[model samples]
Target: MSGGIGRRALITGAVAGAGTLLSGCDRLGRDERFQRLLRTGEGGNYAVLRLLQDRTALAQEFRPDQRSPVFRMNGVRMPNGDDYARHLATGFADWRIPVEGLVAHPQAYSMAQLRAMPSRTQITRHDCVEGWSAIGKWTDVPLRLLLDRAGVSPQARFVVFHCADPQSNGTMYYESIDRIDAAHPQTILAWALNDELLPPGNGAPLRLRVERQLGYKQAKYVQRIELVSSLAGINGGKGGYWEDVAGYEWYAGL
Candidate 1:
């Protein structure tokens, strides 16, 4: 069977396990949430995978020759807001990603300042909840560097990414991850893709590339990273737009 056929079969099984009786994969094709279960083929995180993953294992990284010819843009393509516009007009020279909330030293980092820091370049496959995948070379500053610089408070348990894009429902797009994923070697604030400055369509200025999670967890247009003790009081209080609105698993480990 072709890779496409096998992947579609996997997707069908993943969705069917959600208790949605499907005559076929057609009508349910549009529902792309809750796909992180594919790690062990169950709708919930498998016990063994979750246990070993606690050791901070790295995701599968690909070689440069394996990079996809084109990486498709998912979710909000361009933010429709005045702030993003102002940043875009200046080529994001004035863009500053603020680190606030439960950190000891709050700081806003500039693009140039970030680029000057020690960076990592990884060629990794981006697994989207949509069941499609793309491999691209991404250059980014390790998220751990920023957290170390800000001195994450002892009470801080989760890192929340605030983005510039607002949904049609009038809420801004944001996502959160635990300190484990935030400290992963592959997890980065990617600013460039395929050796080029990140395109606006692909989250220019900065975006989170938490390699171990599915794509929706990769928040784009990130403007601030707020360290917090809990997710209880944020928008919808579930830690992410999809998690709150669409019932996606908060810890979507791949």
Candidate 2:
């Protein structure tokens, strides 16, 4: 769960507005070639970058004062359902993140338990595939520590994130990352943004912040974390909701 790109190859912080995210689908959707480029070219680029870059290199971090004036909430604003509403009404007190799959000990962590764990806060920029980006502060427990507590099995090659948000077909939205990104120092399951409890529009209960990748990789409304050996059986099996339907690359390395 560790990997890196070169120090010079890293992006400092290029912030784009939320609008780019909304139009990303149509822009890429209409152009078959553009989508193909990402699929064939970008995917290989990620592998090459991984080999050339330092596995432990970290994304640039900023000060609180440098936070974005407005951090746009992307993806399902609020997943539709009575269960989700009830949890929201109760301020996610009963919500829990179930860690299962290829773990030695399956466990469900309540919000309180997550907050009680050691946490890291960082101000970093988010880059969306569509063309927009923003900088913001996020606070959450290091995902690596959680994986350690769960005792990830040697057979687990990828980490799957089951989210509360639903995709177009009604299946719950989900995403995944290789062991490298999952163990990166900056990758976290952020429960708070901008120094406050995460808002519903921004994945209130929990969201992932895998800073080195594009925004789509930052899954929101995370309900479960499952370590697995393969992504072949999950929903369209491309590794994410957008990737399954919209052809986004699984490793959106930037």
Candidate 3:
């Protein structure tokens, strides 16, 4: 599991108070398109910046009222697949995220069971690689809890997310994160956004909110989770779809 800190650092610390995050989401986030058009730091030079990273450093969180008025979707609104369609139609009554590979007690967890577990609600900023951002309130079960229950094996070095959305080439999109971020308090498999059941356009059923990284790492329409020892041979094996296909870095921290 590789990770780094994004040196395109606009924030040095948490925002001061209520409505501050909302102001950025509505006012600054949108306007940044122009700012980003002018300058970009050294391209993908993440390794050097990572030396100063605090793996435990929390991404800046916000007040509920500070959530973006319009939380933009990162990738396709809905994934393509008959199984996903069936699950969606039934409100995911039977859909389950199978925790497989390198776990002592592997099992698929249903949405009902996940919701009944200990949950955390957070309002955090999602920084996109494209230079825009949004503050959203998300409720999710901590990934650490699920991993603990499943008893992840010591050999499992990376947590891979197998998603249902496919790209133009017809391959499904997938992403991976290491155990350090996996156990981070804010790393959650969120089922709700903005105090409501996720809308189809917003990764209904489930999505990952790995707040420390870029939006691309926050995979949507996730179908299964595989804990693997290495990323080689998985898809393009660079750690994520964009990382493999688009040359994005595997560990995109901010």
Which candidate tops TM-score? Answer: 2
Better candidate by TM-score, 2 or 3: 2
Off by over 4 Å in 2: 1-38
The ten-residue window of minimal lDDT in model 3 covers: 1-10
Q: CA shift at 107, candidate 1, in angstroms? A: 0.8
lDDT per residue as tens, model 3, 1-254: 13354433324434343457777666764576744542244233355454566767788888778889999886788777787789889999998899989999999999999899999999999899999999999999999999999999999999999988888889888999989889889999999999898887878889998988899999988889999999997988888999888767787874
Angstrom error at residue 157, model 1: 0.5
What lDDT tens digits, residue by residue, belong to model 2 across residues 152-243?
Answer: 99999999999998777888888999999888999999999998999999988999999888998998999999998999999888888888
What digit string (tens of lDDT, one per residue) describes model 1 on residues 2-111?
56568778888888776455544544545455333332354356345567775568888888999999999988888998888889999899998999999999999999
lDDT of 2 at 2: 36
What does each candidate score in C-alpha RMSD?
9.1, 12.8, 14.2
Worst 10 residues of 2 by lDDT: 9-18
lDDT at 51 for candidate 3?
53
Better of 1 and 3 by TM-score: 1
Best by lDDT: 2
Residue pairs clashing in model 2 are 1-179, 1-180, 2-180, 3-55, 4-55, 16-133
